[model samples]
Target: MHRSDSRGVFDALVVGRGAIGATAALGLSRCGLRVAVVAPAQPAPSPLDGPGTWDSRVFAMSPASRALLERLRVWDALDAARVAPVYDMRVYPSGREGAPELHFGAYEACVEALAWIVEGSNLSAALGRALSFAGVEDIDARVEAVDCTAPDHAALTLAGGHVLRSRLVVGADGARSPLRTMLGIAATERDYPQQAVVANFETGLPHRDCAWQWFGEHGILALLPLPGERASMVWSAPQELAGELLGHTPEALAERVAQASWHVLGGLRVLTAAQSFPLRLIRVDRTIATRAVLVGDAAHVVHPLSGQGMNLGFGDVAALLDVVARREPFRDLGDALLLRRYERARREAVAAMRLTTDGLQRLFGDHTGLPLPGLLQPLVGARELGWRFVAGSSWLKRRLMAHAVS
Candidate 1:
């Protein structure tokens, strides 16, 4: 462990170094604040490890998120060849009987592109590089304890017995945040009783820069187009069904997935072994307490079906930075009043997203026979509604997009 004297205390201490934490630290540091980020050492061989290892997980970065990365000067650092533009999105119900299709295109909204499909590791590495260049000190240590004794200052103790003080403490740690737990904040959690099986695969046909989602009896399956002849997939299903998929050999799994997807990609070849993560809805009672605040998964965890998880975290960083940059004279950075501004601004946004995602999960995950017909008509209508929604709400969408980059 390394130690440094607290001559001039840092302006902020950000715990967690995932995409959200790193982005928050970089944002604060770029705004002329002295920021220190604490995280464990980088994973061995990196997280992205195989031909299947080329970041099986990918994010559908809304236009707003793209602009935010651009503002942070990090978007340019990502290899253009690796980034795939999502010019259109196609969502439909699965099966021969009740399936209805909905299409959304950037041309309909008069934008360059609706979103970008990016590998998780590529985005993280780009953000890390930006953080390094912005002079944000990355302390290679785990935080053992955090003490918010004083009103204007919060203190942190690392595993190696190093103590560091800062005006504000931001917990972007993740859903099971140590910092949040240390503050005695408990989360309200509900497991969806489903698992998301993610993988990367090569398709016989080119994706043509379109992302697709098929809502089926099992659950929702999303195929996001990637650079080259590849696509990333998130298949959420019941635990038993997920286990069955997991039990298959790679070649066998590829054949099953190809058939399940109705051969949309023609012959499918699995490039990576299937990986699964249990699905859940996690929301903390309070995101702010005294001198500390929470951001990203540390604040909330939404369903990944909509691909809004990371984007929501980016919203947190953007809002917090705005509040901090506009603090009144003589106001402490960690002052309760100053921190409340962030709380109020983010609470409604987070709540709305939680409700929206939860509602979708519940509506789509129900396999009961009663709501089938009623659900089918609306599912058909949703395709038309989605197109109108995206086209008619340009102003609201622009505001949201702007927040991602701001």
Candidate 2:
């Protein structure tokens, strides 16, 4: 690597240019920080045969996340047609006969919409476009080494033998982030032993902008509305089950999904082949290390059943930007005090979501046995009460909705 002695110069260096990384870079740059983004070369787009080898994941943008994207000037570039607004959400607990299903809608809260479902590709592209327009330096190289021995500056070595220095390094890389490792930050990871099978299809009936979730015996399945008569499905199940699903022909798989989801979308036709990803709960011991901070999956990853993974990362971006924006002129951006402020702002929310999603996944995924007599009634009643808790409180719902838009 070409070593450089340049010190105390760069405002920040962001590693990874995926959705979270790109958004963080854009946020920092917009706050007047000279930022450098190091990202892997963009992979080729997927063919019509199946879900792309490159991540074809879609994200449900909460209101707060959307606002943050707008502030970064990234959301406007997205094609409106490709974006689907979720006006309502239906959640069902499997095998619960006579139990009232829970429903949430934007109208109930007097909001224009609850959230927007957008493809990961579109959001990434939009962020890239915004970054280019903002004149942020893009270093299309992978990081080989990182040194944060010095408090005022952290040094990075790229694969191409170029050394770059920055006041702060942000790890917005995905779960297995190289930057996180380079900084020696420990992560607690729990494999859910389940894989999420995702795909897109055309439904016989239009989704009407409603998102549905079914807590099935095997696992949770979510059908997120897409534009037109299309919708995206995420089926979380055991690895063996996922393999069985993957073994089926595209048409057969579509049929299986229809059955699993109780044919919620009517007759389903696969527009894309199914692809599976192993589900896991990962949380870094801390989001901040000396001279660096972690964002996105690098910081934490929860069950996708709630669709809060990316939104959590966006929360980090927002908080970090706010922290930096308020820093005094002479204070180092990577100073412990500044980093602690960012950490404090994020810990409570991240911890709450992690515990909440993890608890729900375990509770519903249990196939042990059903209760009897009085116990069963209370159990059913409690489920209904939980829904009431969610539906009754606009504060909680609005807080969640706000996260999606940011």
Q: Best candidate per TM-score, number?
A: 2
Please give the lDDT score for candidate 1. 0.79
Give candidate 1 regions above 4 Å deviation: 1-8, 44-53, 96-98, 368-406
TM-score of predicted structure 1 = 0.88
- What TM-score, over all chains together, does every model reach? 0.88, 0.89
List the candidate 2 regions with Cα displacement exceeding 4 Å. Answer: 5-8, 46-56, 366-406
Overall local distance difference test of candidate 2: 0.80
Most lDDT-accurate candidate? 2
Tens-digit lDDT track of model 1 for 1-406:
5364564578999999998899889889988889999887777336553445567778888776777678888899986777898887776666634444556677866678877888878988888889888989999889888888876577888888888889999998888899999988889887877899998889998889988877667788888888888988899887888998899888888888777777888888888678998888898989998689999999999888878889888888888988988988788889898888999998877876776566556555534322223323354335334434533566645543333222
lDDT of 2 by residue, 298-352 (tens): 9999999889999899999999999999998888898899999999999999987
CA lDDT of each candidate?
0.79, 0.80
